[model samples]
Target: MTDTTNTDEQDPAQAEEGAIMRFMRATELDTRLLGMVAALLLIWVGFHFFGYFKNGFAAFLTPRNLWNLSVQTSSIGIMATGMVLVIVTRHIDLSVGSVLGFSAIVMGVLQVNILPEYLGLGHPLIWIIAVIAGILVGALVGSLHGFLIAYGGIPAFIVTLGGLLVWRGMAFLIARGETISPVDSTFALLGGGPYGAIGAVGSWIVGLGACAIIIFLAWRGRANRRLHGFKLRPMWAEYFMTGLACAVAIGATLLVNSYPWPKGIVRRYAAANDITVPEGGLFISHGFAIPVLILLAVGVLMTILMTRTRFGRYVFAIGGNPEAAKLAGINTEWMTVKIFALMGGLAGLSAVVASARLGSATNALGTLDELYVIAAAVIGGTSLSGGIGTIYGAILGALVMQSLQTGMVLIGFDAAMQQVVVGTVLVLAVYLDNKYRGATK
Candidate 1:
């Protein structure tokens, strides 16, 4: 009883300070972000070493190429974003790849024979219906897995693993073990067609406008939070970072647009026996698939859901301490089910986009896609234990994976070797994650 109360209060304050210090010391710079930046730099360096470094290589980094990169990454990127949310809640979905294949088959079957005859729909209507159907089917399948894991109390790994096999078999069954090709032009355009001149201009305008709005909202949110006595990063530092990001966006737009007809290339035979080149009609890069834009929009929406919604908060809390969260009146089980359903819906959308791009449906359409999506998230620094991650981080992770694949091919690496390298990277990432968790504990 010798001033025990005073001793307790003093110890608490000291303990808080110690905890803060420990966190600051333990926190490492985001290696994934650094890795992406490094990978890009290495790509340039490799080009230089290979005697391909020139003004032309700079030209290769055109609006089209940039657009293509965005589009190419979108299908898997969307699935990966959803995976980020699931993993943050300490769950996994191996069925996404199979879900994609199954959804694609569904769409393909509808378009190829069912819808036109049954619904009497035209190409446009059929395309729209097929996409919607694929999404619904995906969601339904995801819910099944969620139910088994949540109310049924099955492990996520087991449920999704079984789902993977089931869905793949369904896809093969739907297509009768044959490939579906020559998809309608309306469907093909979603993946392979350009947005055209007006669409291109519209895209640029919308992109810039969206960037401005994001900057304003972010700044306002930070200021409001600080005014209300909420903990926040330093105001000046936040402002400086925001400004830098804006500057980079503006600079990139100008640089990409400066190239003359980079998106359109034409080769002509001259009367004098010398080949002459002329700029063809303006066109965007093959990477700018419509599905890419769809994926990006979905990513943004999911990010808002995870960071700004109550459900998202519950997800983190449950992952961190389910028992404590349940004690606090959180519906942990329900939330987990909803999240899995959401992930399934995303998987369905990804499959549609990918299939539309390829202009065909096949059982092998989504083969090993899970590996890429999971690798992207892991490399992007999502905690395996859950309760910590970001959409931006996942997207960066996808970029890194895609870049590595694209670069390796450009450098003439064989398919088998590429697989081995990717597999190695994935193992290393898991090992690092385990090490980090051990240290933190």
Candidate 2:
């Protein structure tokens, strides 16, 4: 009789496969992303303990501080997503901060000056109009830079560098170096104060919905692979991934719900609504803020755009090899224009968030923000060499950058020290990314 000892399972390679490798393959998780997440956790915990040792309190990991961090990350996170696309296409936009400042100043002028005159103060349509105008302005500026680069035969670096100065100058000229204040009431909600957050019930609903989507996506991916006769993950692996995603969603919901509105805000709300406060005082949950939701929505849509659209494919193709892409009949110049335009529009939206949060607009509204946005993209694993990046990675990178800054602030680091730390982290991220690429190759 033929020996049927299942020798294939006992091959040397199979025998030597470690548990970690098995798990990685089973889940198809990106090791680099896992490392980034692990690093983020380490940073959080390190800061928490450091604070506890110095100030006798764990300030970095508290729900209140975390919630604020999320809000602070939203604007940069939004812009960083666009920056990924730009970087993926082998380009950079040094003018993003200037564009944001210009956009915010324009929106401020509209809401506080122009629109109010036309639609009357506090008109419901004023904020919407102002936002639309801001986005358009940003897009226009981006398109101009793109035009100069693609058709005008100017290099992207010079064009955008000029734009950085030009847009800021324009913003100053328009606002006359003056600060604009008291934006429309409804528009201010996008900045994410206590009232700007969705309550506990809404947060729970969002979390559960997210879980449902995660499960559905996993199921659909599996089905597609089965239909194509592609290699499939083990059933246990599938379950594990789904459960892990669900757990994260639920955990985030719980964290947001754990943060309560300030006592003063709660008291004011109770008095306004004529509700009696219990002896223990009110504990109104300040669930996910509007800006956070906006960031999430942007992440989802950008992910879809990158992974499920022809434009995204073209972008990667161009980044992989510009000459080949051009030879393949891709309209490289037009694509460049569109990409910059999108980046500009995103910068404008970020401006809306930033100005709204501060309830004002100034020439310096987004000063030095471009550095953080670019750092976030680079840190999130976008290859500076081009053609490799992810929207989710950029967003996570933004969070990481924000966390670092926030932790330093909480630990009493001065502005100069913070910049030093950020610069060092960015260099380290790039170095690690290079090493990772070499190893994978």
Candidate with the greatest TM-score versus the true structure: 2
Q: Which ten residues in a row have the lowest lDDT in candidate 2?
A: 3-12
lDDT of each: 0.73, 0.94
| Model 1 score (lDDT) | 0.73
Error of 1 at 172 (Å): 0.6
- lDDT score, candidate 1, position 269: 18
Candidate 2 per-residue lDDT over residues 230-311, each given as its tens digit: 8899999999999999999999999999999999999999999999999999999999999999999999999999999999
Candidate 2 residue 220 C-alpha distance from true site, Å = 0.6
Q: How much is the lDDT of residue 97 in candidate 1?
A: 93
Segments in model 2 whose C-alpha atoms lie over 4 Å from true places: 1-12
The candidate maximizing lDDT is 2
Candidate 2 residue pairs in clash (backbone atoms < 3 Å): none
TM-score of 1: 0.81
| Tens-place lDDT digits, model 1, residues 1-441 | 565465453476656787545444233235545555676567535633443543234322445545555667877788888888789889999999999999988888888878778756455688888878888988889888888998999999999999999999999998998888756567766664453122535446645866697699777978897899976755555665567667765654554344333433322213234644436543332222466567667878888888899987888888788888899999877887888888888888887778878889888888888889988888777887888877877877787677667656655678998888778867886686677657767
C-alpha lDDT (0 to 100) for residue 287 of candidate 1: 26
